[model samples]
Target chain A: MILTVTLNAALDITYHVPRLQPHTTHRVGEVVERPGGKGLNVARVLAALGHDTVATGLVGGRTGEALRAHLAAAAPGVVDALVPVGGETRRTIAVVDGESGDATMFNEPGPTVSAQEWAHFQDAYRELLIDAHVVALCGSLPPGLPVGSYAELVRTARSAGVHVLLDTSGEPLRRGIAARPDVIKPNAEELARLTGLTEPLRAAHEARRRGAYAVVASNGPQGLLAVTDEGTWRAAPPARFEGNPTGAGDAAVAGLLSALVEGLPWPERLARAAALSAATVLAPAAGEFDGAAYERLLPQIDTLP
Target chain B: MILTVTLNAALDITYHVPRLQPHTTHRVGEVVERPGGKGLNVARVLAALGHDTVATGLVGGRTGEALRAHLAAAAPGVVDALVPVGGETRRTIAVVDGESGDATMFNEPGPTVSAQEWAHFQDAYRELLIDAHVVALCGSLPPGLPVGSYAELVRTARSAGVHVLLDTSGEPLRRGIAARPDVIKPNAEELARLTGLTEPLRAAHEARRRGAYAVVASNGPQGLLAVTDEGTWRAAPPARFEGNPTGAGDAAVAGLLSALVEGLPWPERLARAAALSAATVLAPAAGEFDGAAYERLLPQIDTLP
Candidate 1:
């Protein structure tokens, strides 16, 4: 079973307006809500692709209940093992401009997790890992949790003989890589921030040397660059899909984890990651992909060594 | 007992950010939520001033539940007679720029009340009016309700021998005034929209001639201009208070109702309304007043003949 953890899950709300203007009143025409978090996004994509996935995170208050309800209704295939906390789960609002398709985001600070809650989550995670083959620690740590949260989770998964993928940024990612997760997927900007290298291949190699067994760096529209012990490869889709790119990276993570669990080669894994990500950009909402596009783009991906 | 009705109530959420720039994301530093709708605001202020006030309106779903929980905690003095509906309650967000103290508003269209729900509310309204000395019908008509909703409520209150105050704008106010409510409060803009007259005294007189026995026109920082059957008076605070004016009008409504219930003359009522309104502006959040300021400004109000 594949396990994904989102320490700071959110109830994502999208408000559609004719046009967005700052410091002016807007009467939203439509409102769309979904359960959101990096781990939840990846888990949904994996489950949709016929993989057995479990999602665990800390949720609390009425907002948490609403997020759980939305998850159950939206992704029935994924098992939920979320722990409850004291504070209300935060909400993230994306005001989408109907004309330009641009999004203005407002993120509420998520709930502060208590010591007991954090301890409880660690125990719950350990239990989930007992039956898990691979685990993905995703997103930022909510307030009150130590900055080394992802690092600790990486070590736990490694000790349990489960493959772990660390996908985060800044201090958490920096500290997490030191714990030597099996894989780390950072976009070009995150790669630069982590290794201070502008070139993708150089940065991916630096990240791998730091701790990860393999490093896959996303180069936005250009696609995926992978540096592994076996070999180095660059994978790109035949054509770039233009739409919302909100959850495209999460799709890449899901593809990588799914391919790894299936024991695919590094080149094949990159192809899968690039294709799934390109397909996700064509989707209207985040955490969703166009299945037909994914299937069509799979073989059209160019994988070069 | 004073009964206040908010047909289209809201969970008002305020987000404080350092600055508001168009097309850019904002990380809100503080989030303050309140149970809002003009009538509810009036009820809260009235209760705060030791008046027996009952708050009634439509609320539904999880957002409504949150609003109710907040109301129960914030205004324990006000009795809750709010009726439940099938649709989720709407939320209004005010993103306040800390730099300029300006607010950008986004209003979600509230739940549409079905015919059955409207009927249930009317029955509940009639029952509540039995023990009420005065009633205030406030705010907009949510979708799926007749535009003459306030008009119908005005007639119902009149039939129950309850003094009714209409405080709304646009077509509802136009239609509601013809029902001959005892009093009507219209802000400068709302007055112009209703009577198409920019002058406060002329517009107030025009509104009174249509159906209202009295008309109280709020002239922004200038204070209150009242036209009634007995006479006309203009009331102003000793000094203008500069602060948030979000709920100043609702505080004015509360003051007017409290004085009317006590059988105070028109001049005394205007003084109470103006002072309370001014004090509300000095408070940080809406539906609240600076008690010390309210007390200090009350006797200092100048009522002109």
Candidate 2:
């Protein structure tokens, strides 16, 4: 079983408008709502790929209850989530202009979690990790949570003899790396922020040297770069494609975790990650990967040193 | 008892951002969610003004559930809403820039009410009008509802010996007025659309001539004009105020209904409406009126023949 954690989950709402004008009223043509957050997205893709996954997060209020109900109805047996009490779940509204393919996002700062909520989440995480083969701590920390919250979870998972993956940014990533998780996935900008290196290759190397066992740097359409103890490798898509780019990084993380849990070689894992990300971009909706596209792109992905 | 009917109810979401730029992501500084629709807004104000009001509407899905829960928590014993089986409630997002006092609104097309949903809502409306002194049919009709939806509701309320106030636009307003509603409130644009007269006095007269007992036309900061069988009067605020004006129109309707339920004369009702509207414009949040400001402005509002 693979475990994923999202401390600040959101109910993502996408609204399609002809155009967005500031200080004016717009009639939205369409609206789509879904359960969202980095960890939830990763866990969804993993479940779709036939992996056993349990998603644990701090959820609250009516929005949290709705999110849980939606996940239960949509994913059923695959998604197991633990909800906490208190502030309502956060929301992310994406105002998409379909004609222009431009999206404006409004993200809410989710509820503040109390110390008791953190302890409750920790207990649930420990219980989830007991039967987990690999654990991924993902997304931003909610307000009132300590900066090293992810680091504490990583240490707990490591002590339980489980491989841990840390995917976050800024201070959380900075503090979490000290716990030496087995894998850390950071995009190009986040990698630059962590290592203070503008160059991708140098940044990947720097990140690995800073206590991460293996550093995976996702460079958008360019593909994935992995710096592992075995060696460094770069994977690229066979071809460039045009489509929605949101959630491609999370798909790559899901692919990497799926292969790693199955004991695949590092090179194979990189190829799978690149292929999965390419497929995700090809999918019409955000955070959804086309399985057929993934299957076709897998053999075509090129891994090089 | 005052009964308010919302054909299209929405979960109103307000996000505070420093500035709004098209096609960019913004981290909202603050967020507020409330049960909203024109009738719901009127009902809330009436409840706050110490009136016994019930809000009936077509609510569904998780958003509908959230709307009901929010109303229950915020203003318990104020709303008696009916939940439909299909289609989630719509949402309206207002991006507010506090510095400029400007808001960009994105309104979703509410759920398509099936025939069954309409029937269910009509039954709920009949039950709510049992002890109601006035019934307000507010906002636009949802999809799949006929254009004469408001007219049917007005006729039903009249048959039950309840005075109906019709507040809407286009075909719904045209058809609703033909049923001889007690009152019709239209903004400058809607009045122009209904009467094809750019002049406010001419539009109000034309609306009153078209079977409505009283026609109230709200002309923004200039205040209100009313044409009734008794006489014609224009009510103006003492001064222009600056604030969020999203729900001022609804507040005006609330004041008009409140005055009418208390058996005030037509000129006094128009004065109260104008004063309440000005007070709403002075309030910081939408759908809220400053009680002190309203009281102070009440005596200052002047009506001229």
Candidate 3:
């Protein structure tokens, strides 16, 4: 079973407005809500791909309840190992302009987890790690959690003999890479922030050098680049697709983790990751891939050495 | 006892952002949530002012639970007699720009009430009406509810010998007024839409002609105008106090109801209502009146004969 952890899971809301004008009241035409976070999104795809997955994190207040309810409805097969916290979980709003299809987002800073809550989560994560073949530590750490929380999670997963994929940015990534996780997935922007390199190849190489066993960098529509212990490979998309890009990186992470669990070669993993990432862009909303698109293009992605 | 009905209640959420830009994400600095709707706001102010009040409406799903929890925490004295429905209650978001103090609002159209849910609410309202002295039917009717629902509520309150005050807009206001509610409060623009008169005093008089025993119209900083069976009067604010005007009208409703329940004269009622309205503008956030501001301006408001 794969264990995905979202420290800052959110109740994602999308409000459809005719036009977005500043300093005016809007009558939203439609409202769509879903459970969201990088790890949750990854777990959603993983479950859809017929993988046994358990999602564990800190959930609290009414928003947390809503997130749990949605998770139950959206992915009934996936196990929910979420622990409780004191503060209300946060919500993120995406006000999508109906005319332009552009979205403006207002994201609430997630609840501050108490030190006690952090300890409780650690116990739960350690227990879940016992049965996990692979673990994915995803998203930013919420307030009150140590900056090296992801690093600690990586270490714990490693101690359990699980292949862990750490997907994050900034300080957490910098500290986590040092723990030598089995893999790390960073988009081009995050790669530059971490390795201070503009190029994906150099950034991934530099990231691997920092102790990551494997480094995968997603470069948007251009596709994915990977530097693994076996070899380095690149997978480029056949065409460009433009839509909501919010979940593309999470989809790539899902692809890489799925391939790792399947014991696929680096080239095959890179190809699937790139194609799935692009296919997610064509899906109607975030965190979902178009099966038809995925099937048609799955065989078209060409991996290069 | 005062019973305030908010058929289309919402979980009001305010997010403070440093600045707002289209198509960009904002990290909210603060998040404030409250149970809201015109009637709920009125109930809150009433409870704060030491009145016995009960808030009733339709609430369901996680948002509804949160709203009830907040109401319980904020006003323990106020009775929450809200009924349940099948759909999830809606949320309204106010994106407040920290630098400018300007807010952009996005309001969700509340849950669509099933026919069965509407019948269930009627039963609850009928039972509550027996113990109520005054009933305020407030805000928009949620979708799937009959447009004449407020009219029916006004008649029910009247049958129970309870004075009814109706505050709404458009067709709901039109149908509700024919029930001869003891009072009807409409803002300047809503009055213009309902009576086709841009002039405040003229609109108030015309609204009274439609069967409301009294008609009150809020005219922004200018204050309130009233046309009652006793006479026509205008209560002007002492001065303009600008802030979040979201709950000014609700505060005015609270003041008028407090005065009505006390059997105060029209002039005094208008003065208190106008003073409370201005005081609410001076108060931070919504549904609150600054006591000092209300005290300082109450005696100063000049009621024109």
Give residue A51's lDDT in candidate 3 (0 to 100).
Answer: 90
Instruction: Evaluate model 3: give its lDDT.
Output: 0.90
lDDT by residue (tens digit), candidate 3, B1-305: 99999999999998989899999999888999999888999998899888999999999888899899999998887899999998888899988887788889999999999988998899999999988989999999898988899999999899989999999998999999998899999999999998899988888888888999999989999888898889988999877776767789999999999998999999999998998899898997577789999999999999998
The digit string of per-residue lDDT tens for model 2 on B24-143 reads 999998888999999988988899889999888788888898888888876675866665759878888899887786889999998988898788878877888888999999999888
Model 2 per-residue lDDT tens digits across residues A30-106: 88878888898889888988899899888888789877876777666556666676998998999998678899999
What are the interface RMSDs of all the models? 1.1, 1.0, 0.6
Tens-place lDDT per residue, model 1, A128-247, is 999999999998888889999899999999999999999999999999999999999999999999999999898998998899999989988999998989999999999867777889
Candidate with better lDDT, 2 vs 3 = 3
The per-prediction CA RMSD against the true structure, in angstroms, equals: 1.1, 1.6, 1.4
RMSD of 1: 1.1
lDDT of each: 0.92, 0.89, 0.90
For each candidate, give its TM-score against the true structure: 0.98, 0.97, 0.98
**Residue B245 error, candidate 1, Å:** 0.4
Candidate closest to the true structure, highest TM-score: 1
lDDT of 1 by residue, B1-305 (tens): 99999999999999988988766788777878889889999999999999999999899989999999999999999999999999989999888888988888888898989999999999999999999999999998888999999999999999999999999999999999999999999998999889989988988889988999999999889999989989999999987677888899999999999999999999999999999999999987666899999999999999997
Tens-place lDDT per residue, model 3, A110-138, is 99998889988999999999899899999
